[model samples]
Target: MPANHRYSARTAFLLLACTVLASCGGMGGSSINPVNWVTPYKIDVIQGNFVSKEQVEQLKAGMTRDQVKATLGTPLMASLFHADRWDYVFTLKRQGVEPQSYKYTVFFKNDQLERFEGDAMPSETEFIAKLGKRRKLGDVPVLEATEAQLKAAEKPKSATASAAVPASVPAGAPPASYPPLESAKQ
Candidate 1:
């Protein structure tokens, strides 16, 4: 309410604003943020049971192993290396895509019977219960390298200077000239 008190408060507020602004100005130019965390619990659940809409109707649990496989087809990867667990990973991705997968892992107790699991990962019984019918399989996928990628894959050679940076004439520079006397007289 007093004049000196009001002036002091305004001065303190301005100093605080300047300090905050100065601290923040450098952050916009940098590539990395100082604070980040990547705990497994906080990670995205890209993995899950993702059956095509048709498979939605017929999938039911307690179906025999053969019946489940017939409905879902073979697991994406099975281990002769380990054997018991089967991984049926299906992704909903577009062309030229790197879609995240829904990893439905089935751990068979005997390596033949289903066991416990991580979430989004379905029980084999659940997957079977979920599969209404067989969905048609599509072509296997591949990524073609870009031109820069192919060039980078090639062995590096410093001798190919022209290939790396072709010489550029200055924007308004005149073309180089030969002697006019000889060319013109002849």
Candidate 2:
């Protein structure tokens, strides 16, 4: 190839590469990017302690820390600096749905639960319902066979067979016994 043609080709390739890279760089934060339109699958992220309303309701003013822990698994955040305070935090992040976060704080005095407060905790059923996706079901088809179809499916018995014998063993045959798995000692 001529020197000029080779130089031109090199320049064109360099320009193409730069353009492609620039386009990709621009797409990182742009809403119009192809990736933005078709999002990659993101698994549901569930984090921290999930304290239900029932569990919180079980908490009493004089209940011990162990009792509180028993009712509501374990505290997600327990700081050494704040020995008397235990924080229970729950966060759920799922694609195509708003993220959910709930925080509950328990204060203890003399190793006994003094008071507890935080965001209104959801019932177990309510939390479960939020996690599940409800899809509209299509009309179901009839599953049971019609009487005519059942009659058509019946097989005619063979003339030579007096009775249907069990597939594994004959009706009158005794059950076969197996030897002991271990050998008898001398």
Candidate 3:
């Protein structure tokens, strides 16, 4: 064989080997990469509920199982062997953002909340900020209504309900009056 032919064959074999290797890297659903410049889009890897500080604060010793469940939704794990223990776990992984994980366990005594142990939880506001959602807090006054004001608030301001609410008033402002839907049939 000519030297040129042998060299060309060797070069072609190397190219094929490199291409095969490059494609094989991700064959097993693996994420390993040798050279990855462009950021490969990775969907946010959210696994569990993002338990907020408020939820943790709501937990208190002596709270009933029902109350605890109400405060912090259903637990992630409830072992049959450990019937009195409940576990709450949350994890988040977003592109460009640091990963976060939380593990909380609540122990029950006689079906009542005994105590809870876990990492420090963040408040809802803080969690939202961590998720990169920044928004200006509404500059709204918190009024301490008098007895008369409270009474008046119960009455619907307008005879007809209006969706166009004033910026000052929060949405879902209760109607002024709520007559019985169906009066007791005499």
Give lDDT tens digits, candidate 3, residues 67-168: 998899988899999999998999988877678899989999998888799999888888877786533467778678988889978976673555466556
Q: Write the per-residue lDDT of candidate 1 for residues 69-146, one digit (tens) a residue.
A: 676567787879867666777654433334545655555553244542333545556555544233346765667888
Q: What is the TM-score of each candidate against the true structure?
A: 0.29, 0.58, 0.52
- Over 4 Å off, model 1: 1-64, 95-98, 116-186
Alpha carbon lDDT at 175, candidate 3:
73
Error of 1 at 59 (Å): 7.2
Q: Would you give me the overall lDDT of model 3?
A: 0.83
TM-score of 2: 0.58
| RMSD (Cα, Å) of model 2 | 7.1
Clashes of each: 13, 0, 5
Report the C-alpha lDDT of model 2 over 1-186, residue by residue, as the tens digit.
Answer: 899999999999999988986796786678765556677888889999999999888889999999999998899999999999999999988887889999999999999999999999999999888776643468789999999999999988785564556567876898689779999989
Every candidate's lDDT:
0.57, 0.88, 0.83
Off by over 4 Å in 3: 1-35, 133-186
lDDT of 1 at 88: 72
Q: Which stretches of candidate 2 lie over 4 Å from their true place?
A: 1-37, 133-186
